[model samples]
Target chain A: MTDQLSLTLAALADPTRRAMLLRLAAGTATVNELGAPFTLSQPAISKHIKVLERAGLISRGRLAQTRPCRLEPGKLLELNDFMDHFRVVTEQQMDQLETYLSELQAKGTEK
Target chain B: MTPAPLTVSRVFKAPIALVWAVHTDPKHQAKWLSPDNPEGYLSKLDFRVGGTHHYGAPGPDGAIMYGTQTFREIVPMKKVVLVQSFADKDGNIAPHPMAPTWPREILSTTDYEDLGNGTTRMAVTWVPFNATTVEEATFEGARAGMQGGWDHQFGQIEAYLAGL
Candidate 1:
């Protein structure tokens, strides 16, 4: 039972999948359209697309007969939220260090 | 391939000696190293090379989440390097409580640069230590996604969200 963040990071680990996401960022694209830039075969591209879809990074829309893949901004926001944890930790630690230094200085002044 | 190290740098308004002391002293370490609020505490510390520092705090559900860092190098007032790992309450190495796939150990190197004028610049670098191929790949993927592609994706996502 992989978490959403683990799935998202695993899906993003591949260069080919990242390239597909970059292409989808522009606008919606069909399977062939998404695979146009890559030399990979149809099934290979499909596999990459499936990973992205599973991770909720992209979604496919049924427009008539053509299924167009579009980027899902919500998943990107989730990824951002995950990374922000480290930022918050770093900031909080720095704040605590500042306070500690001030207390040390105050002790030195009293001596 | 190994991923690029995650690096963070900051300048402190204190002297290099004071900054180094605060970082190495277990009493001072207990004051700031905890990530979440003030719920965590450093349970044990040995401020010497080859010594280990074990710390933990109660999780939201009241379970203890422990971590350890073994000192590898200590340069007085200048640098410190350590290998960090998650551990059980008994101080034995254990899988991360939240993310089992997280690397078992991370090598952390911190450099203290004296900028003069009672200020010190601190830079820290973190990399997976003795990781398996899968762990290395995961770290590489995260670094690639976070470092180079984040800003571009953020802009696109913001615009896309605004349009919705």
Candidate 2:
């Protein structure tokens, strides 16, 4: 899952790729369709789709002669889980900090 | 319950311009933003009103954390408002997968105040927008933990700036 998330993030880093994701989220489309708004060639769009497929964020299936790409929500779930881990670590540290601060106040009062 | 707006405010001993530069410049931002991301990278940044920024960085365990923001308001050295979301491969906006409860979009605002004494006060606020019941609940539930994460991130920025 972590491996998948890293791939997804790396793939999504580019604005072009992120735009592709947005279009795919709306509905599946062919490489040519994805390229239309960006004014890129079909081959260029295909490359982006390939990157996404490698990241497991999307998959391509042949519909007739055209290869249509579809968004796979599962990998996104994996990435979200990875981000949530930070929340856990942060809260634990905060708990420890609060305890230490209270102890400091107590010691000061004792003095 | 709709969560109270989540915020992370920090005071930095730098002039407002310098701090705003750090916040707005993509290269400078990549240096200290998103501390959880060890290899922070800002892929695309459009700093004007209605501009968009796409950012990605390697998480602690080596996964990439990617997010996008669209600028809605921009005021020189004073305020910036934007809408942010997670993006999928096609650059399409997506929601947090695991937190199906999370709002699909977050409205974020950052205000900078010149505090004199070479210091700048920054306050950032985030709130869910047009969220479903689950999303709103998830945001409210995660508030405390999110606050903790932001606190750590601010500390990281302070340290990085101090080291410079």
Candidate 3:
């Protein structure tokens, strides 16, 4: 079962797709312009685009024939909280690591 | 494409060997890894190739979640690779407490780099191991978000959010 968070995460998983999101973040871009920086073929680019669209990370520009894509970041908050939890844990661990290291060295200096 | 691995890297003020000690020695791990209550077995480390290090710490919501590490490889003062999985309080392998779709086993590799000038850099890489399609997809998705998270290394997420 593809949960919303999972879908968002999976869409962002690909380096190409993530970049596409980043490019879209700067401004909207048609599929062609989005595909310009990489060597991926048109179909491959389209496939990546589809994944992002499916995740709700981006939306198609309805009026334009070129069908530019814009970053739809509403779904990202969900993933952000998840990733934030991860970062907080890792950050806490680092803090502990630093404290413990100091204690270890302090003991070492005593010997 | 092979799914992206969840990675965390940090520079420690201590030397490499000292930094490695905290990870390899149960006593040291108990000291640093403890979030709230570290159970008895959590401190009891079987540090060997093919050894199991069962541990428990408070998850995000402050309830304890159990997990275990089966060491696959160990390079002195350099790297340690293991299979990381969720476990019951008894240390039996179990599904994730929060996300059942979460992969049961994740291949975890941690590298200790001697950054010279009396400092160490610890890098960790995590990827689902022996996972099914859904498991892999979940992991890939988690990792994709983690990249922005990683900046959160992968750094445009904040800007992307702000620009919107």
Candidate 4:
């Protein structure tokens, strides 16, 4: 878990790398395909992909010697779990705020 | 692959200006933006075009979630376009500590429409920006999870408004 978290962080540390990840998310693409939007060189895009590959966020496949990328959904579950706590806490506080607001409204109406 | 855009919206029983104020005002933002972590803090907000917003929340395990956003566009009591990212203390993009696959930067656009009658409808759209295949995959793959997260967070906010 720690490794994946750190790896994810490492991959995100660079903006170019992050854009590469977003490109892959749309669908699997070759280095050439992914580099089209940014006009980055294939080598530069490959370097970014390498970082993601090391992070285990993606895996490259060989199809007639052409490597393509695809989105790996598993790692996101880990992220969802980590972010879940924030959602829970926020909900609880909102409930409390609701009660407080109600009382305030009641007092206002009484006046 | 082109990243798909993600959007979420909520309605609040408050004036449009008040809702806009809450979103743009540092003091008001600090109050409710951290619904999950009651102790979440809003460190700073410079709510203008080119300004920035910085906020943090503690995780269940006590790890901190620090995030920042630079305002790209701002329309008073109406709309805000910003580039947001999880960041370290220095305001540099950082991977989410818990999810290595999450996107580094999420471009978000928030719009507030006045429905009149003291009601404001707010919408926030989040899109993965400058992400890698894994990062993008991580975000796209977790649609259900993201929905669930928003359900809880927004539900809480709805409840909070109901009481008012």
Pick by DockQ: which candidate is best? 3
The digit string of per-residue lDDT tens for model 4 on B21-57 reads 6566655545554545554664777777899887776
lDDT per residue as tens, model 2, B1-164: 55578776767656787677666876655555444442456477877887888877555566666778899999999999999888764457876654443567899998999999877787878888877655665565455324544334434433433443
Best-first order by TM-score? 1, 3, 4, 2
Supply candidate 3's per-residue lDDT for B71: 91
- Summarize candidate 1's per-residue lDDT along B1-164 as a digit string, tens digits: 67678777789888999999887776676666653445466478887899998887554465666888999999998899999888988888896544455578989999999999999998888899998765665566566655665646656656766687
Candidate 1 positional error at B69, Å = 0.7
Residues B39-157, candidate 3: write the lDDT tens digits.
43254468889989887776546666688889999999999999998888888999754356678899999999998988999998988899887778777867666565445444566
Instruction: Give the lowest summed-lDDT range of ten residues in model 3 chain A.
Output: A82-91
Better of 2 and 3 by DockQ: 3
Per-candidate local distance difference test: 0.77, 0.66, 0.78, 0.64
Candidate 3 docks at the CAPRI level of: acceptable
Per-model chain B TM-scores are 0.83, 0.79, 0.83, 0.78
Candidates ranked by DockQ, best first?
3, 1, 4, 2
User: What TM-score, to 2 decimals, does candidate 2 have?
Assistant: 0.52
Question: Which scores higher on DockQ, 2 or 4?
Answer: 4
The segments of candidate 4 whose C-alpha lies over 4 angstroms from its true place after superposition are: A1-111, B34-40, B60-62, B147-164
- What tens digits encode model 4's per-residue C-alpha lDDT throughout A3-92? 675465455555566556656655678877766778677778788888778877678888866688755556534544554643454344
The best candidate in terms of TM-score: 1
> Candidate 1 at B125: error in angstroms?
0.5
